[model samples]
Target: MMKKIVPGILTVFFLLISLQKVQAWGFWAHQRINRIAVFTLPPEMLVLYKKNIEFLTEHAVDPDKRRYAVEGEAPRHYIDIDHYGENPFNVVPELWSDAVQKFTEDTLQAYGIVPWHISRSYSWLVSAFREGDVDAILKLSADIGHYIADGNVPLHTTENYNGQLTGQKGIHGLWESRLPEVFGEGYDYLVGKAQYLDDILDEAWSGVREAHYALDSVFNFEKILTEQIGSDQKYSFENRNGRLVKTFSKAFCTSYHDMLDGQVERRARISILRVGSVWYSAWIDAGQPNLKELIKKVKKGKKGAENKDEKIEEEKENNGHKLKIIDRESSDLLGMRDVHEMLFGECEGHGMGVGHGHGRPNKPHTQTAQGQKEGLWPLRMRDL
Candidate 1:
């Protein structure tokens, strides 16, 4: 009785752990992508991003979290482009308006809208930069980094995302989560500096097309490898976060990683470069504002709030220039609602289930109760 109960308990625990990790690119990868992208920024923008690096890194998973909290948030993380047909890129229009006209907004939303959402997020980031809203800029930067990372993920571009249809269930987590968490330390992330993108939408589609092109290898190699290594040797139990969890054996992971010929590393590097380029492009479009000045203004405002009696020091630091101090609390009020409303025009229904093919059942779409807008900012400056 004791033996049977222990095994059952362990099974439940492992399943829970696996479920938590099956999101797009996994939280660890997402944060790493965003953190590394910061280093790729030019000095002009680095001054601000460096100071708030932690905020950017930690908030990289905000969009994933919103899938469970905000209405219509899941679709922004992925696109099942394979649903469109053999030549999905050419079959589906690149522009959001054009695609909507061809497929209807409801039809497109039913599958996924990651590429279009990337463009929308990019525009919002440009707006945030132009407005010099530190909070919004940070928030949108982190959020856009996530969508861009997702766009580069091969799994995010397919309807069979998790391998459910092809009997390769759990492949999503194995490829995106387990492989990266295990071998990512050795990856060379010095992906050089970010360049400004002339056309954001074209860049976004380019990534999707490249990722989609690799889909056959992502699936075929795994299938071939699995046939070579029997189930007994394919998986093993290991301690993760202090608990024994069953996962793809290290040998199997190594085989698959080698079989892919550095595909995971390539995608991750691309994500970093693309994230930085998108950010730099947004800054350029925003009239090349001095990010260093934004940092100084934020610090001055924070200092003034802390020492109200030091009006003389504040004035002297201002150097006769009027400092347009942003109210920290008020500025921080911006959340996903603004982005959702900006792109989709409504934020009413709960989002679909975890769209990265985590094998979870679709979450029922229902109306969320009012007044639950807390924890929505992608980057919370207060914590910074």
Candidate 2:
């Protein structure tokens, strides 16, 4: 009886251990992009933004949270442009209607629509500005920031996004979450002022196109590095936020960072500028409304204007673990849990949404994620 029970327990243990949760561009990076983007606004825009900077930063990860709760949220975060063609832009129509007409909404969504979604987000922000709707402006700004940051990530552009196709699984979290958490402090955040976009849709598509161009390097560098260092050395288990996590070693991350030669930093910088620029453009297009007056008109909702430091305090206590709430967003917060191996036994309240935490299996990082063998696909498409 004892032997039988022990084997059953061990089987359950490995099963849990094998389950992995994937997150996109770490939560820290996403929030940081939104927070810093505020400073990039000109005085006209900055006046309003600086007033509500806290709201923008805290809500930056809201889009990721919506993935679990909201329908069609996953596809908005990324695009498997590679699925369309080698030269994706050339084959896929630039306009949303044209794309839908060509591929049908179901097929377009069966892949992803991040670039087009950015355009939609931009338009909403413009409307918010035009109407002086403070709530809409802030919400849309935070959301648009999330999408633009996703667009900048090379991993977010591919069919083999998580490296499952090439046996380099976990690369998604490694590149987006770990690298920035380890080395982002040194990155310069002063990206100058935001500028108006003459062609919002064009720029949105450009971001996705450029990201696609860098896809090869994103995969090859990791593949080559793993071969040189071996997986054991490439990844190391260390204590993070009071738990042991298997993540890329500093040496390994450094080597990979060097190989990318500013790719990650460049992408992050572009995300910051784009976020700020789009926000600024929206304000200008809205006829430069008086944001102070607009703020007064904002309706009080479920949560009042709580202390801005609430999130900061939470971050300090959790060491950024709160953001990891399984379904929240991508960051070390959602690093795979070792329930049986750890003294804690089981994760108490790990993820944010229903599918989050211990009960549910990990969902794919993007809805349109393909090449699902070897558990590489964390982002899932319902149709596929």
Candidate 3:
């Protein structure tokens, strides 16, 4: 009786752990998007981004981590376009000011503001490039990549993101997380070099529209496959991190992957190109700053113990603002918890909806393009 009880307790404990992981199971894709985007950069911007590849890759999921810790952070990760109606693009205004005027800021926050947030973050990235702030540039680059990647996910754009409303719960992780975890190695990521966008806002909307267009296929394929397969064949326990964890069976994933007809790979490839293009555009907007100089300055600043003392003094002069920036950079290096691992424990509460803490109840506060020049960081760093 005691031995049996111990096994039951362990199963319960692991299930709880898996639930936490499902919330962030998509972190791997986010990190992969940022990492691969580095290769898409041109020689000019590539010099800086490539040197700090690890920083960009690791911090790609920083926004996801802030979802629970930061108040307004969750809304930035997604937008529920379906909440607007059948023709959301026509109903919702493209410009942030226009959207706020039409829907009221509170209403907008209650839904989502991802596209607008992407535009806002792009402006901030441009400002960082112009100011030649290495820390800010790198941080914002990683963050914008995360948002752009989210924009490409069909689930991130819908009200029934996790399929809770359709009774096919857990489809979110199955599509975005498990499928990639199993077959991503074979997916082609060579999306070609990044191209410049004339209007970043238009580009952001286009990506969201494309992803939204694929929304039906995302759900329909899974439903069809579910009907054909029994529960035992649909899911299986596998060893992950030295623990038995339940996940979508490889055979089921393969069938779903085939049904999608390369949709997942296509979206991921587009995300990579878009991320790199945005980074390049920001640099171009900043008058094509010599990124090599910024790299040199960073190297110079790290030279000696004497220079470190001077850095401390400089931070004191700036009221520790510089120290705060350094601390943030250090935190990125130390790495945050991968939200994907939390999915392995339990799969509940993973819905990307307004009520599930995915959207902010209060209005979002953002800096104008002009304000970013004065070093006004947006909600990302402010709430953190």
Candidate 4:
């Protein structure tokens, strides 16, 4: 009885591990997207975003947490486009009302409403900005970024989200979670400034449409590589956070990444740009309230805001690697001094012309609720 029970327990443990792995974009990727999107905002919005950059970055994964803990949360993370028909783009209306009119709200919700949720999140953000509710603005901003990022992921747009349908049970995690974890650090993230979005709902739908189109390649490439490489070479066990766990081998990930030929990176970049633009647009629509004043008020009321230098200094002391944490205050001062002398330009109170620091330090700069080191930032915050 003991022997039989032990084997069953081991099987359940492995199964739970696999289920957990399939969560959205891995936690690190979601946080990285939110952190980078901050840099893309213009000075008006940047002033506001940079003040609460930590909040925005840290809370980016809240929606994922809520999916498990809150009712009606899972639908916001994905949409099974193929469920609608051959051309989901043509069949599905862009507007929320039109969509509900064509297909009842229950039907839409049953399928998933990620694209619509993106638009709803945008509106909520705009309201938060207009009201100047610092907490609401931060929470909604982080949440919207998550939905938009989810919309950008090809797997999130498919019915075979976890790939249980096509004998590719783990492909969802492999594509969105694993590929990015292994190869993402080296990809180019120099996405340009955020432009104002004219139609938020249309933009959301466009993202979903584009992601749906990429689904075939995401599935086919992995399946092809699996058949070629065989299982032994494709998987290996390694220590992660002090636990021995099985995962796709580096060689397998590299081969699959190569076969995709930059789809993952392309989608990530697009997601970053879209997230930034949508945030900026919401601020503008809300009459461009003074985020600076609000932040100042919040800071005064809340004691013990982490000192920027202390955090960086602590990181510098403990980090084993050579990578340095770019000093935000000094970097801004230097960037402004250079800009003023070179261009004879006046620097804004916010560091607009100043350059971005390199992406998050080599070591984790923050901790998760679980007390584990959260990952680094993906893009440098602009000096502005």
Candidate 5:
């Protein structure tokens, strides 16, 4: 009786743990993973993307669900970058080139793309194609959509990233998830073909730089308009969770539109459209194949097995864990209870249309961000 009860309790504990992981990665993770799949898509699958908009429709919420032919390609978030260094930013984009050499197949025995960092996503696709599998390609295409979508976001690339700032807190969700929900679908999906990137690191760093520059308007333009426009016009009343709430105002939209000079939405739409195109491009580049061939070599999703077998498999994976494929967090951070996780977890509370903390901190960063040379330091959670 004791043995039976213990097994059941263990099973329940594991299930609960799994559910939090599903929730903690947030909507962006799903989107980012799709971009990985995009660069590996085959020709037939590529054509399907343009012929139909259904992919975008069904996947906008959780795009990473599309499994690539390669097992374990779509993975849990949190790159194991911390293991390699004290601070990734100190090295800058050099990490990307290093990743290329590391993935170039020195110690690695298999012919697959490595998942070193979230930013190295594109490099993985470029190499995965050499293996030549259709299912693998499509899987990466779906993942590509996710990353490109995240790229369009201003916060994902910034350190002030989450708006732990001057009381305009939770602006991260407001800008990326909220605004897109209300206004994104209406965006035009007709962007030009994705030009082949000669150097992925250059493109990636360029993206980071672009997102960095946008921080000026995202963080400052709101304040600039406040001096001239009335407060009421900058927000609107809406019912959320049966509660009447004042949200962003028409004047705020107008001001942002002015700040972007009308490029924000267009760029977003371009990102989505390019996501599809790249997915297709990857399939073509990957040597368009029959998905059936790849299906023969790989299986989809995990299946339940006997307890002993499961234990053995888990132990095996744990022992052989590769930095190229794993993301990690501190034991304390990973072990926090649900409510604690929701408040502090990477993927909850502030996502989408939820909440914004918008305020100053008791202690703020003395320095500003990279592009903000005018100030003593980039304004952080304290300045808002």
Candidate 6:
């Protein structure tokens, strides 16, 4: 009788563990922007674009509670040397870790490859339109907005991530999340229609390298100004909860402005404008024609809603390898494997996708409220 009850209890225990992983889709505002931008899909391919949009919107945030916004926060320094044992980069593949294919695949799998992830997302966007429809091009152009915006962020790429070694631990929060949150609205929003970007990987890497290299100045300037920045002047009044919140004061802002010489805000403005331009360019690539007519063309060319669900049935049957986890939903695309290799890289075998890593034990385990709710002891998530 005791043994019979054991299986039931275990079953209930595990299901609840995975519940925490499921929550709001994205933590980054950019991801939220990407969610809304999908609507810009050309009318002809609107339905397909929506499908892809939903995919990205679903898994925009981290599933792990410990690092819910891991990527959202850049690393201030490389991991402690002791953590990696000896000669760190040897074991952990970073920047150029995997072969170009695998590396790119990994990038697409994770958070930092914002531009490529956005690009691959667009492939599904392009597929939604008619083969020859010009109007479909305009919509694709509009979708480029998000990827282009990604290119502007220096933190979007590189190793010395969030000023950890540089001693500015919260710098990631200040620049990427907070600054943008505060001043984004004042920036220019127009960049004009996008133009074709030649050799997208090179462009993306260049963007990464530029942002990565910029870390030097980002840290240096802050350090140099630290002495002059008084606690009171550096922290002042910002309205919050119907009361003023003490925060970066006008003095700090003035010093930051002096150091940047207008570059910080300029880059933000450029990012905003270029996002709009790239969106326009991708549309041009699809051949700027007419929206409604192209919509009819796609409806006739591809299997619309009638055959849509069936397209992914086979991918589902075979080990879940063909499923692309966008936003969080598993989009079972027919040629995801081929395109996955062509655009991103050679994907790992089944179970190697982002956050779904194999053999991880600490992933929250299903526990009844009466079970190990307070804390998990010696048995790790892997053991569980």
TM of each candidate vs. truth: 0.76, 0.72, 0.76, 0.72, 0.50, 0.49
- Residue pairs that clash (backbone atoms under 3 angstroms), model 2: 324-333, 325-351, 326-351, 364-378, 364-379, 364-380, 365-378, 365-379, 366-379, 367-380
State the lDDT of candidate 5 residue by residue for 175-226, as single tens digits: 6655555555455544544554444444444444455456667777656666
lDDT of 2 by residue, 1-384 (tens): 455555655765554343323443477888999999999998767767888899999889877755643457789888899898766778999999999999999988878888888988888888888877776788789889999999888888887999999898888888898889788998988899898898888988889888889888988998898899997888788885598977789999999999999888888899999999999888888788987666656634213533321333122233322321121222332334332222222312111212223565644354122422221224212211
Best by lDDT: 1
Answer with 4 or 5, whichever has the higher TM-score: 4
lDDT tens digits, residue span 1-384, model 3: 556545654665676455447655588888999999999998988888998999999888877765654357788878899999999999999999999999999988988888888888899888888888988899889989999999889998999999999988999999899988888989999999999898998898998999999999999999999999988799999997799988889999999999999999999999999999999999998999999988888778776534554422123334323322333433332222223222222222222222222233433445455433433333332221
Candidate 1 TM-score, true structure as reference: 0.76
Candidates arranged by TM-score, highest first:
1, 3, 4, 2, 5, 6
Q: Provide the global lDDT of candidate 1 against the true structure.
A: 0.81
List ranges where model 5 is wrong by over 4 Å. 1-57, 60-91, 97-119, 123-135, 230-233, 240-243, 273-277, 288-384
Predicted candidate 4 versus true structure: per-residue lDDT over 1-384, tens digit per residue = 556545654665555455456553487888999999999998877777887899999888867755643357789889888899897888988888998999999999888999888887787788888877877788888988989999999988878888899988888779888899898899899899999999999899889888988889988988899899998899999897698979899999999999899999999999999999999999989998887787777787554433534336334434543334544544333333221222223322111223323332333223233322332233222222
Expressed as tens digits, the lDDT of each residue in 1-384 for candidate 1 is 456545654665565455456654489999999999999988999888998999999889877766644557778888999999988888999989999999999999989999888888888888889888898899889989999999999999999999999999999999899999889999999999999999999999999999999999999999999999989999999885699978899999999999999999999999999999999999999999988888789889878886754323122233334333334454333432232232323322112232331344533322223212321223322211
Query: What's model 6's TM-score?
Result: 0.49
Stretches of model 1 off by over 4 angstroms after superposition:
1-25, 306-384
Rank candidates by lDDT, best first. Answer: 1, 3, 4, 2, 5, 6
- Evaluated at residue 355, the lDDT of candidate 5 is 30
- 370: Cα error in model 4, Å: 33
Q: If both were scored by lDDT, which would come out higher, candidate 1 or candidate 5?
A: 1
User: Regarding TM-score, does 5 or 6 come out ahead?
Assistant: 5
lDDT of each: 0.81, 0.75, 0.79, 0.77, 0.45, 0.44
- Model 1: lDDT of residue 321: 40
Q: Where is the poorest 10-residue window by lDDT in model 3? A: 345-354
